[model samples]
Each structure stands twice: as C-alpha cells, then as structure tokens.
Target: MVENKHVLEISSVTTSDRGVYTCKASNRFGADICQAEMAIIDKPHFIKVVKGTNTVLQCEVAGTGPFEISWYKDKKQIRSSKKYRLTSQKAVISLEVSSFNSADVGEYECVIANEVGKCMCSATYILKDWQTPLIS
Candidate 1:
C-alpha cells in the first residue's frame, strides 16, 4: 500500500497572512479541498539623537528579498543625498539625516517591501538641544 501527503510551513507571519489558505487534492473520481487560518504578532521602538548631530533611522526586516526601503519625515518621503545618507545590509536598512535639528525632531516612518509583501512601521526621535540659554 502507498500513501501521498505533504506539509507547508510558514515562518514569522503577519496580519496579512491571517487569511484562509486552501489546499486542493484530486483523484480519478473527484477533488477534495482543505483550508486553515491563523493570527500573528506585530511594533516600533523609540530612537534618540543629539541636536545638530548626525542621526540614523533604522528599520529591521525579515524574510526574502529583493527589498525596497524608504524613509519618511512627518509623512513626507525622504531621499538620499549629501545631507541624507541611506544604507542597507541584509535585514537592516538605515537612513542618516545629517545635522539633526529642531526641524528634524518629529515622527518618522520606515517602509520595507519585498516581492512577497510590504510592511510599514513608525518611530519617534527626540532631540536634545545643545545650545545654552542666554542670561538676561
């Protein structure tokens, strides 16, 4: 006697993967199908940098690539330049915003995407002003 069977495993699944998945089997007579669904885990951590100094905003990602990484300041997309530097190594991507100032103190968003899917995350950076207050 012989039996045919198979198995599928998913690692580090997110909310998007929670939907129902269908598996189909066929024989000479007819066909059979099965389905399964599951929930998953998820967040952003805070980052701090000194005022008027260079700062790096990094995002951590997992799974397969080629991946696209992007940085945003206050809902606006940011690009790489002399003042802004972008770097990527494996699962980590970073954006360096040069000369961190009052204008740069705000919410930042890091968007990571691959052929499989896309994930968006946000974190806030607090600025520590180095300028001393003038005496009256």
Candidate 2:
C-alpha cells in the first residue's frame, strides 16, 4: 500500500492547526514516510471603491497554484448573474465590476487551492455617490 501523499479536507482551518502531517506507506521493498507542513492564514484584505465607477478587487498569495477564485457579498458567494467578471493570471486574481452601484458594495473573496494546500483572501468595497463627492 504505497502512497505518495495523503489528502485531508477540513473546513474553517485556523492557525492553531498549523503542524506537520505525515503519511506512511509500506511496500514489499521497504517503507517510506512523507511529511507536509501547513499554516492556516486569515482572510484577504478588502479594497474600497466608489459608486458609479468601475472597481477591481485583488488578492495575492504565495506557495499555491491552480487556485479557484470566488466573489462574495457580506460573506455570501457572489452569483454568476452577469454583473461581475473575474480573471486570473499566474498568481494574480481580480474582480471586475463593469458598472458599479450600491449593489456592488460588499466583501469579495479569492479562494486559492492546489494539490498541496489551500488559502483564501478577502476584499471589501463600498459604493458611494461618485458624483456627489466631486461636488464637495
């Protein structure tokens, strides 16, 4: 029963869970041990924006690849209802608001995960009256 690595799925993993994970595999030839270290992290920072203007929210990370990005509002998944556009390049991920409004005011999230580990980042923006700010 030789294996390369072990897979573990956990929700709400925190810094306290940071430690080493060991996998033991034995075969007729011999036995081997594979160890992996992981550290839990806090959510991403929020970016502020104004109303009636285009906005881009970004999240950056290290030591991860092939991630999955998601947008959220007040902690809920941002639905794909044709109001938001998200794009990723290499390690950079961003959310594009074509037409900004009060509805776009909230927190956005970028979730990254690879075969080795997973991480998440967050961004928050508020939509203010862009025209009104210019008057004052």
Candidate 3:
C-alpha cells in the first residue's frame, strides 16, 4: 500500500463558480481525468414601470439557461396574447401590457426555471386615483 489518503475540497462558491471543473492525475503508465459542471439558479427581480400607460413589466433574471419564463396575474398563469406581449433576451424577460388600465391594477409575478431549479418574484401595480369630495 502507498498510503490511502486523498482530499478535494471547495472552500467557497459564487456565481463565478458556475463552470466546468476538471482534475487530472498521471503516472508513468497510467493517466486519469474527470470533469463536472456547476450551474447557478437565481431568482427574478422586479423592474420599475409607469402605470396607466403602455408599459412593459420587466423581469430581470440571472441564472443558467435555456430557461422557461412565465408571467402570473393574481396567482394565475398568463399566456402570451396580442394585448400581452412576452419577450425575452438573455437574462431579461418582459411582459408588455398595452394601455394599462384600472383593471390591470393587481399583483404580478415573474417565474423562471431551468433543469436545475425554479425561482420567482412579484410586484404590485397600484394606481392612486382620487375621487371628488362633496359637501351638502
């Protein structure tokens, strides 16, 4: 026996840690190598937009892809339609709601997932409409 002992450890991990890692060892008559991939799954975040206007709800996300991103309204899943335009490029996802009206005032959530995991975040669209006060 040539001593039975080996150790391989990763002290800390960050976004930069998401990549392929390889280890290789060799002897005069033999060689060995191994590789693995590390993927990161991050949650979506809310974006600022104006209400009562043609606004695009932006969901800025960061994670490994190809990802399946979806929008939700009042806890209900929303599908792409003429009025609701959905687009995604890189890590940014958008839901275009044309002529945002009073009926559109509600909570909306953005969810994204890959083969690894799923993450989501929500934002509330509120409109402060004032009514006239009357006195007798």
- Which of the numbered candidates is closest to the native, going by highest TM-score? 3
Q: Model 2: runs farther than 4 Å from truth?
A: 1-54, 79-81, 130-136
Q: Rank the candidates by TM-score, best first.
A: 3, 1, 2
Q: Which is the better candidate, 1 or 2, if ranked by TM-score?
A: 1
Model 1 Cα displacement at 22 (Å)?
22
Number of the candidate with higher lDDT, 1 or 2: 1
TM-score of each prediction: 0.54, 0.49, 0.67
Which clashing pairs does model 3 show? none
Q: In candidate 2, which residue pairs get closer than 3 Å at backbone N, Cα or C atoms, i.e. clash?
A: 44-121, 44-122, 46-123, 46-124, 51-128
Between 2 and 3, whose lDDT is larger? 3
Cα lDDT tens digits, model 3, 42-118, are 53333442222335666666665778888898898888887688888776678777666676777887788777778
Itemize residue pairs with steric clashes in candidate 1. Answer: none
Cα lDDT of model 2 by residue, 11-35, tens digit: 7886677889887888899998889
Error of 1 at 126 (Å): 2.9
lDDT of 1 at 111: 78
Superposed on all Cα atoms, the candidates' RMSDs to the truth, in angstroms, are: 9.4, 9.8, 6.1
For residue 84, model 1's alpha carbon misses the true position, in angstroms, by 1.1
Candidate 2, residue 109: the lDDT equals: 65
